[model samples]
Target: MKQAKTPFQFMAASTLTRICGVQATNISELLEQLRRVSTDSVFNHTFQSLSAYHFLTEGFSNDFAQWALAACNAPQMAEQLAALDIRQYESVEDLRADLVQTLESFVAAEPQRAQQKAFEPFYFCEAVTVTVPTDWRAHNLREFCEALWHVSVHSIHYHFVSARLRGPQTNDFSAWMEHSLGLPELADRVEHIDIYTNTLERVRQLILDECIPWVES
Candidate 1:
């Protein structure tokens, strides 16, 4: 009998989409289909969908992409995705999940910027006004993290933040929070929190506490 391939062994994004029967000839079209079936605007809102496209097309096979497409096209198969939660995995069993290696690499490579809430789901839900899926909770973590990363790290919101630092946007999640967004008072409270000197968890908490409240208003 043949053994199953691991998540790390998956093919590139373009190839995966084609194998899944999507007719797109390029990454952009593939993403459109992905968005259509998934019904999420987070990627479009951030414009980092292109960056993700570049990553998957080049060599990296995003585990989340596998689920995203599957959830959009074949909802029944999504239970497979649900079984492999990448939330706060701590050991071999955690890594033993289908997406274990990919999630480990992903979390390890996280900019270590924010106290990221490990994703619980593999699909999008928050920004959608449509009727929520019965399986929405299962895929919430992956989609939410993807959306948050694009907004906080890859999108024009992040770009504007980076422009103020006059450098790579990756370095200044805080600068933009202090200067551009709605939390000036909160920014003032954290203005002196040294990104280098203080713990990353602390910094992330400050940002989350100050920034997330504005989402409701």
Candidate 2:
């Protein structure tokens, strides 16, 4: 059965296709997502929260800074948000308001400031997915499973960043991998693993063992 179309999934899909020629399901579907980043309240709040995290931590924490950059979704906004003093806002609400105001003013200042990049997702996906070990893509089952695990990690990052920017998501890496990466049987295998009951290593092993027949076929 075709899964129900979700507002958020389509929201993400439309944004990606319009900007990078990529969709949540495939790189070919080029529908325009109706939601614009500038008007997305949740995204703005994510930006504010991430900025505050960076500012409160004094930008000394690489992990916090990276999340802020991901939340920003653009180099220009990341640099601009990094320079702002978020502590002065005193509360998360204040900080968010200020962040939104600043972003709104920035948008007003330059209406044509390359807004096409707002919905881009592939670059972020590739950036996060590349953290896998160099040899993890070997043809062996163990390596293949490790590679799939890396892809799952990448999907988690992608979901996190997108959720922060777009709100909660109803999709998973399994369907995403099959639709976006063109790996159907592998995706079905991945979707069956229970991350809640099993450790990541265990889940990876399960996927590998289960996928052997698929690979052979």
Candidate 3:
């Protein structure tokens, strides 16, 4: 019988240690037998944690691409991501850089920016009129991206909060958004708190790992 491969480690010494050029039968042996390897053995716990954050940020960016493609039929961005092999991004900063580049390319190819139109088209029964863009532009890419990210994060937060607060009865985005952001709120709703915590944690990780490194560079 053959031995099974180990489950992928979220944190694995083997991950960094396993080199392609090494001549060894097993990962463990490869690490042990290798000589004269250039290893930077800095015990910067903060830096490692920051790397994890960058990984998560890239993960989130991938997720966002999927969502955008599904919701808006904008498969170009997603296709570009896959073509770029962004999943193999060496570091968090690399992932962030690629994501920004992908967005920029997409925007640059667009002939025009989506002018703010009446929010009436998107407004459902519970949705209030909020002017929204139908498409994205590359020129003012950063500002557009900021708005896109803000809406998505808050949208999820509101959705979760509504599910907990309004029971199973509420079925639409409008109702959920209103109730979630509405007046007197209670402590029992786990969705709002949980989602916010998770999202912020992800954001903080991205900033430390991806943003800081890029800024320093």
- 183-202: candidate 1 lDDT, tens digit per residue: 45644554444332323334
In order of appearance, the predictions have TM-scores of 0.21, 0.26, 0.26
Residues 55-157 of candidate 2 have per-residue lDDT tens digits of: 2433322222233355334455545544544323324344345544545555566555524443433221111112222333333333443455555433332
Instruction: Choose 2 or 3, whichever is better by lDDT.
Output: 2
Report every candidate's CA lDDT.
0.31, 0.37, 0.31
Q: Model 3 residue 133 lDDT?
A: 32
| Pairs in clash, predicted candidate 1 | 119-141, 120-141, 121-138, 121-139, 121-140, 121-141, 122-139
Off by over 4 Å in 2: 1-177, 180-183
On the 0 to 100 scale, the lDDT of residue 161 in model 1 is 21
Better of 1 and 3 by lDDT: 1
Separate clash counts for every candidate: 7, 0, 1
Clash number for model 2?
0
Q: Which segments of candidate 3 are over 4 A away from where they belong?
A: 1-61, 111-217
